[model samples]
Target: MKKEFLANLAEILEVKETDITPDMKLGEKVWDSLALLAVAAAFDSIYDKVIPVKTIGKCNTVQELLDLVEEDD
Candidate 1:
């Protein structure tokens, strides 16, 4: 799931997978409104949870975003 998430995010942002680091924040110029929307949709479709855009916007890194949707198990 993590692999798919990273791949999808990289694709959505039109960047190479190698370019995305765990510490890279999505709020960077690379993530425009459309990218955020796409990420919101991805979270819903992949995690079965509709994460709010504002919440997602607060994320500081790829790892942080992934951690947001991580199950508590």
Candidate 2:
């Protein structure tokens, strides 16, 4: 994932950048309900994408979450 994106997410989730990784699971200790909302808002604000909560629900890792927000190439 992009470093800037990772940093932005880490800040939103209130975790250190070092703590975030592709394998990191969402809804774990650091990613709670408020963090989930922040993720949604981040996508909307950064990418203008409206990510469905259902889609977020299915993501198991930080990579999955980034995939949800990243623009298609």
Candidate 3:
């Protein structure tokens, strides 16, 4: 799950998978609407759940986003 997420994020950010780390700030990766959409899509496809934009906006770091994905809700 983690690996697939990293791959998704890598493609979304157009960066190498090694470049991502839990502590990395989404701001540093230029977090934008497109990235948000991509993340939402990934969650929808991977977990078959739709992540709210509001909840997603609350994530400031990669780990937070990862945690959001793992959440039961």
Choose the strongest candidate by TM-score.
3
Q: What stretches of model 2 exceed 4 Å from their correct place?
A: 71-73
lDDT of 1 by residue, 1-73 (tens): 7787788789878899887877876666398778888889988887787889998888879988788778553
Please list the C-alpha lDDT of all candidates, in the order they appear.
Answer: 0.81, 0.79, 0.84
Clashes of each: 0, 0, 0
lDDT minimum window of 10 residues, candidate 1:
20-29
For model 2, where is the 10-residue window of minimal lDDT? 26-35
Off by over 4 Å in 3: none
1-73 per-residue lDDT for model 3 (tens digits): 7777777788878999999888899999868988888788878987787989778878999989889877896
- Deviation in Å, model 2, residue 5 alpha carbon: 1.4
Alpha carbon deviation, residue 31, candidate 1 (Å): 1.0
The global Cα lDDT (0 to 1) of model 1 is 0.81
List TM-scores for all candidates, in order: 0.83, 0.82, 0.87
Clashing pairs in 1: none
Ranking by lDDT, best first?
Answer: 3, 1, 2
- Point out where model 1 deviates above 4 Å: 27-29
What is candidate 3's CA lDDT for residue 43?
Answer: 83
